[model samples]
Target: MAFPILATLVVLIALATLVPLSRRTTWLVRDLDFPRLQIAAVALAVLVAQLSLLDLRDYETVILLAITLACLAYQAWWIIPYTRVFPNEVKAAVSGDRDERLRILTANVLAPNHNAEGLLALIREHRPDIFVTLESDAWRQRHLDTLEDEYCHAMKCPLDNLYGMHVYSKLPLEDTAIQFLVEDDIPSMHAMIVLESGRKVRMHFLHPAPPSPTEHEESTERDAELLVVARSVADLDTPVVVAGDLNDVAWSTTTRLFRKISGLLDPRIGRGMFNTFHAGIPLFRWPLDHLFHSKHFTLAHIQRLPAFGSDHFPMLVELAYDRRHGATQEGLEADAEDEALADEKIAAEPVSEADVHEPQA
Candidate 1:
């Protein structure tokens, strides 16, 4: 039993390494995340099994332990993105004015998560200039009314299900538009605001449903919504900021392509990775919560705020759009090819458009 279990451990360890070579293994992408945690369980089971192997010699056991140590190192590789030590290319964009600060807080109050006091408490403490909430219902809206006085500018849409979104900002909003990019009723807000110092900034708040067995079919709608926004970001002359629960990991193919195409910078690199979602357990943490900005702003600080009775941990980011005094640098990457993917027509799947035009939902 001990020898068999040792061999099984070796095989499982080897299988996990192939996650990076996902072209050959189809389920690897889906299961790679699962095995990320199970490795320790595998290690413990192997240890228990090996210890009971009477026939194994001491030297042989030592060799097995060495292999286990190597597997441990492999298990830690996923943490690279989570730790946010990405290279210069992925580093945070610099700013000319270091003193400027813009605070943003993004929270997803799980529609059923009835802990309104905790969320209200966080709002009272943070006092962020820009605030966004996901999965908001009519009840959540009522609970958030207390915030109206602080961040009086409001564009809110509350729904029964979890895709509802809202945004509140202190900056002077010029042209605020709530758009239904893919389907109707699931609205996303787009606004242009001028800072007190006359710096104009574009802000977008989105909460698109993820593609899963129950929620959405193919990723066409999600992909299209993101790509359209990416295209808009590319055309902007001034600073642009897109923050939301994209429902895709930062390292996924779509996400990398989004960053490259949008000409945006992630504050995660060189800074710490504040993994949000699954606040119930930290082991399953991923940076599903995010804040991406254009070259004009420098991220002063970013963090995943404490859980606010939701599955997704809220992300709070402080951004200042003033450029720093550095010799202007270039060589920025632009997604010239991503446009085709954005504009390409999707197979318009049959969706329940029951409330095609829901009454100001």
Candidate 2:
């Protein structure tokens, strides 16, 4: 009993602190940073579980194993919008007056994946009015044009590399604009969209690359881009919808801060963790794709799509905000320590004087 509980704590601690200890890796799987850490965490956990079987029928050992599994669940699914230990990231309080009811889908079609026909088929089948794609190329641009009639309003920033981005929509776009908010060549799209019901939402689409020595060197720029957006949403007078690959899990400190800052509702809460990445492999799959909305909009449906030649499986969300009660909130969910930590995280993000510019007209 004591041994298993003790071992479980050790494993949870490892998972929690893996990022800070292993500065070399940020992502846990694929050819990325978190791969080794995730593997080690799982391997160590399995060893702990097997070691406990030494005393079969031991109720305490069984209980400890269950508890250990529970901890793993919490780490992966729950702990995000409420981290308390690390307060070094930027955070802003959620604010807004009206909820914008609209449905949107964001996906990252790996540039190298040639079988994009399936993805297009899925898009046509689901028929989301608003679609955002990351890691796109020219071939993708031509193939995706099939929706040009359906989505008359569109923005395309195609590149030969993985940074290509595109946004297509049927909604009336106001102030539709694209900018490289952080790094040049890597673009993000932001625009005002009005739904058929007269509801207007400030939609921001982001797909910033994650932090690793080989990537952007550190999360400074990533944190800054998110903080800038978070602050923008926090200051908004209307409901907002920000979505994309994010490159970070929906439950990461940064994402949580974005939710808190934007006052958005994660449909996944109380719902299952919809792992979106690693569709090519089973053992390494997790939810990297996400959809979050203002409280006014209720989730009509949210699901992970089948693989379409990309490592990430796209997510589709149907939202309706014509609620009887208006927008409800999750409240100021973070503690002062974590809140301050978030403040620091945002503050410490690297910002250049040239980075600040007036929003494009």
Candidate 1 residue lDDT tens string, 253-318: 456667766777777764565768678986676667778887666556676778867898877888
Query: RMSD in angstroms, all models?
Result: 6.1, 7.0
Q: Spell out the clash pairs found in candidate 1.
A: 95-323, 95-324, 96-323, 96-324, 96-325, 97-323
lDDT per residue as tens, model 2, 1-361: 4575566665655565444434232344212323333644664565475465446477865665565555455454343332333231211222222234455777899999888798889888888878999999899999889889988899899987698999989887787778887778778887878877677777778887777556865665676677667666654456667788877765555666667665666776655557788887877765677666565555666778788888998988776664444344453355566556556656665543234322322
lDDT of each: 0.66, 0.66
lDDT of 2: 0.66
* TM per candidate: 0.76, 0.76
